[model samples]
Target: MYGYEITQKVKAETNGNLILKEGALYPVLHKLEAQGWLTVEAERVDGRLRKYYKITEAGDKERVNLLQSLQEYLKTMEQLFQPKWSY
Candidate 1:
């Protein structure tokens, strides 16, 4: 999707829990695009030019790796926070 649409969809899905300011989003987009994780293209939409992003094959692998690492981190945190003995 185009940039604004991408931001809107993320905000809607997160229910306002996470908001991406352009300051944060665009740089990441560009960085991912630079890292061969995303293919960026420009198109004319609604009488204006917009850039869209499509995740590349590398991005899929990276996403899986990142999610796995995040899950492991969360599990460690849960174990650390669990009750050590009867209260």
Candidate 2:
């Protein structure tokens, strides 16, 4: 998806808790493109040029790895936060 679409989707998915501004979004997109994790395609939409980004195989692999790490971290945090009972 394009930058604006991505921002809107993330906002909606997160119930408006997350907002991605252009200043932050574009740089990340550019970096991913440079790293070959994402591919960009430019097209004209309503007389305006728009760039759409697609995830590459490597990007998907990285995403899965990151998600697994996040899940493990969250689980550890949950365990740490659990109340302990003393007899």
Candidate 3:
């Protein structure tokens, strides 16, 4: 559920360019499920049932790791793009 909401928000934040078609989304979700990082259940919305994903404890831990790695990546990019000092 939260991941779906997050996916929607990410899409909106990127002005609809955060393209994760169902093909990609479902595969990553399935991988997470296999790794015990998430679980899914069906939920009804507007009379149609959709599979909802929920993060497990392992997923929360992975989220933290992702955030940390992203931060480090940004820092590296920033340093790499900085102008070099000239004597």
Candidate 4:
């Protein structure tokens, strides 16, 4: 996924449709790049240079970890909210 495209996704899914500003977004991206979890490519689009981000193998593992964690979190919430049947 490209950096801009990811930004769009994050904005669309976030409340108030707020896009992440460089202050937050850039640091995370740089950290991921430094950690080898993401790769970046330079491309010329509309005659302008643009950087695109691609997920690496480490990132795939991370995605799975995050998904599993979220699933467990949801399960915990469900158990807490389940109806009590005690008489």
Candidate 5:
């Protein structure tokens, strides 16, 4: 999806808890493209140029790895925050 669409989708998926700014979006998009994690395609829509990004296989692998790491971190946090006594 295009940058704006991606941002909107993420915000919606998170129930408005997360908001992304264009300033950060563009740079991150560019970096992902450079890292071969994303493929950028340009198309002219309504007389304006728009770039769409698709994740590559490598990106999928990385995403899974990151998700696993995050889950572990959350588990650790839960343990740390658990009550000492069951009241």
Candidate 6:
């Protein structure tokens, strides 16, 4: 998806709790493109040029790894916050 579409989709999915800004988003997109994680395609629509990004196979693998790491980190945080009882 293009940058704006991505931002809107995230906002909608999160019930407007999360918003992505272009200033923060584009740099990451460019970095992913540079890392071979995403591929970009450019097309013209309504006399305007738009760039769409698609995830590569390697990106999917990296996504899974990152998600697992995040889950583990969250679990650790949850354990840290649990109340301890002393007899």
Highest-lDDT candidate: 6
Runs of candidate 1 with Cα error greater than 4 angstroms are 83-87
Question: Clashing residue pairs in candidate 4, if any?
Answer: none
lDDT by residue for model 6 (3-80), tens:
999999999999999999989999999999999999999999889999999999999899999999999998898799
Give all TM-scores, in the order shown. 0.88, 0.86, 0.73, 0.70, 0.86, 0.91
Stronger candidate by TM-score (1 vs 2): 1
Worst 10 residues of 2 by lDDT: 78-87
Q: Candidate 3 at residue 9, lDDT?
A: 78
Task: Flag clash pairs in model 1.
Answer: none
Clash statistics: count for each candidate: 0, 0, 1, 0, 0, 0
Segments in model 5 whose C-alpha atoms lie over 4 Å from true places: 83-87
Tell me the whole-model lDDT of each prediction, alpha carbons only.
0.89, 0.94, 0.83, 0.85, 0.93, 0.95
| Residue ranges of candidate 4 with Cα displaced over 4 Å | 12-18, 83-87
| Best first by lDDT, ranked | 6, 2, 5, 1, 4, 3
- What's model 3's overall lDDT? 0.83
**Number of clashing residue pairs, candidate 2:** 0
Write down the RMSD of all candidates, one decimal each: 3.0, 3.6, 4.1, 4.3, 2.6, 3.7
Candidate 2 residue spans exceeding 4 A from truth: 83-87
lDDT of 2 at 55: 99
Q: List model 4 lDDT by residue over 16-65, tens digit each.
A: 47877757788899998999989999989999988998899999899899
Q: Comparing 2 and 3 by lDDT, which wins?
A: 2
Residue-level lDDT of model 2, residues 1-87, one tens digit each, is 999999999999999999988899999999999999999999999999999999999999998999999999988987999755555
